[model samples]
Target: MRQGGIVGPFPSARERLGNGAISQSANDWEHRYRRTVIMSDTVATALVVGGIGNFFGARDAANWHEKWGILAFCTELLVLGALAVSRSWAPAVLGQGADEFRRLGRALFTATVVLALGGIALTSRNIKLWIFVAIPAIALVTMTARYLLRLRLHRQRKAGQCLRPVLAAGSPATVRDLINRTRKFPHLGWRVDAVCTTDGLGLDEDQLDGVPVVGRLADVAGHVRRDGYRVVAVTSDPYWSPHRLQRLAWNLEGSDAEMIVAPVLMEVAGPRLHVDAVLGIPLLRVSMPTFTGGRRAIKGVVDWMGAAILLLLFAPLMVSVALLVLMDSRGGAFYRQRRVGKKGREFTILKFRTMAAGAHGARGELAGRNEGAGLLFKLRRDPRVTRVGAVLRRYSIDELPQLFNVLTGSMSLVGPRPPLPEESAAYGPDIRRRLLVKPGLTGLWQISGRSDLPWEEAVRLDLRYVEDWSLALDAVILWKTLRAVLHGQGAY
Candidate 1:
């Protein structure tokens, strides 16, 4: 097939194949990156374990090796062994999402358990020190190191390095969506260099959103083999039958390309998805979202405890904001609105008043000037906003009072955005999934772009959160919330 007409500034298929430069870059960097991570993990584990041993075994200078040296050596080995067993160093998970940290955490937990068991078997008192202090400290250090490494890798990706060349095969629409997403999130490390549609056609004859449409659906494996594409992304299309997909997989065996099939259930991911082989056929099984269980119980406890701590920490700031609100407008210092919570339960949500006394009454007048998305009613420069209210809203200081709701079990620190009664009432069956868990003080919507996101995008993010909710995801959202608030990009 012709390799011309590739759009954008990216290298075309012919250019890429000419020097075989980009083709080998993925493998080269992946190998180097994996080695770096292994070294980082080893050095970090050794340092933490060695430091702990020295601090505790210093009492017996001459016998320190016999006493703490053996235990420390064993601890280090166990930690490394756990990491290897857990696939924490897997290249596929290195620089994106919560999976890398989650695997590291699992490794640490495994190491801790093994250490405890070994301690019991050997009757050693130092095991408690390792389990209680050393392991936790190691976790902190290693996770921080990994996060730093990810930041560096993200920077490199943004600069157009360390990327895998993707060969996308699907309908034109799906291919276009894939192109847009890869361009939008370059940090994910995918670059769609070529495309293959049903009849070797794209939306624009030869190019689909700047990516060259090189071949027909049947030509996918051929292009992958000839051009050395690193990833073969098979998006949803009628052309790919089970037998065809199996053949494609078979064809991919000798090549380094990883085959990724996009399931129809794209919105649901993370731990909720499992692949089970039944009767020699691989079946994609989706587990139901958990609303009640040990994890939910833990989430509740974390909400209450976190809210209590935040309230205590922000007490003075909250009081000062209340005083400012009272002085700024002819209204009470706090605003109370009935919002829909988990299970469609109604609860009074509180915030430091950021509008005039009768702001709700006047909302009708500004209906045409509405800038909010979907069911939300907002105005970028609403006349009802007091000076103090504007500042509060800009920095998200107005939401401080929601901590009290979290403490009271009416909300969580991380979940879907709580909707008003009218909004909840208007929710269709699918959208109503947001009410399955308690609302959150901050969520995917808050950290993503706040009120600036499009209506569909906002709902998609909220639904994504509900479908892929995990404690690790919650922690990631919370960490990102700080940066989002500081930027104040989408706040009204």
Candidate 2:
């Protein structure tokens, strides 16, 4: 079963160790852990299918024969079984990133395809009605259930529950960085319980980055067995050659501990990464950044259409905001500031004016009191903002006028933040990448802490969005923007 010291292909400890007692304990715990996720999904699927079936069955008694009802029940069970086989309830992805949602979507698509083929084989016209009802009902109900479960997982993690104990193995610096990141985002659910260094370098100090140093790299396997650590995370370290990692992975196998290697690549989204096997070597492949194509064209159309619809819906509110702006200050209802747009095109960004008529002129005098990131200027209690302006800025009501700019193609519904001319002038070559696409009314920065982000973080997010533009990602950002505005976490 061994291939150059790599762990066997099977994930089960019993297959590797042949120790009935130890493997049985691991299996039981894993079973119980997986049960919660599986049961939740199972209940959601049953409710959606049963509810839809009963409703439609009552509506048309002639169509809902006993045989047809039995067929519907069997079809629902088959789809549920398919979802289970796809590992939609896998514990590794349950409370984590977008993988859970992605898996759910893939499973649903598979179910649809299977049902379509089955309907064709059976020559049944009623299957069309079932497909239409089941797809939306299953998708809505299952996604809602998973989101609620994720919220519970996050709450539990905050209270220090449902986290796997991790033993970090690497150099002190990488281990420290990994530990800090784990602490900062506890919802990812890895708690660094101990550390093991290359040569026990920091063991004398007893701790590194708040995690206790237990042993040298050679003692990692012994520590896992002794302390019952569930995960061993190996980050970048000179001592961890391929052979060394393979040997480590082998030793940890069937010990109730899983080994995970964290690549040094940072902040790259999952969509951009793939693993390629070439000549028995595992290589990480990063896809080329996409900037132009059919999708981009579709995005442009969506931007214009969505902006027009929103403007129509919010016209009354926009008018109310304009009146408030005029009553609170002696300025025009609308303000236009020169901003750098796509490919360095300068545009006059529109907004309901939130400051006095001469506030721009007074910006120079308050430069010394600037509180914003990099070249940006901000103040918690600016003298320029009118009383009404504060409320608008807090809830982002002032930015509604930008829908016109979106319609005009000067901005997008979701993209990087539109920079001021001054900010763009100071941008380095790397930062200029943000100008690759049209600037946005809202973007990653808006949903991810907004004005509270540091200059470097804000720039990074903008560049990331520019490099990895997808309509799906845009939809996610727009959805999050609503939550962000409601919470008012970092708004001015």
Estimate the TM-score of every prediction.
0.93, 0.85
Encode model 2's per-residue lDDT on 69-160: one tens digit a residue: 65468667866877787888776777677677777877888888887787778766667756788767888887777777677667766655
Q: Return the top candidate by TM-score.
A: 1
In candidate 2, list every pair of residues with a backbone clash: none
Which candidate number would show the highest lDDT if scored against the true structure? 1
Question: Scored by Cα lDDT, where does model 1 land?
Answer: 0.87
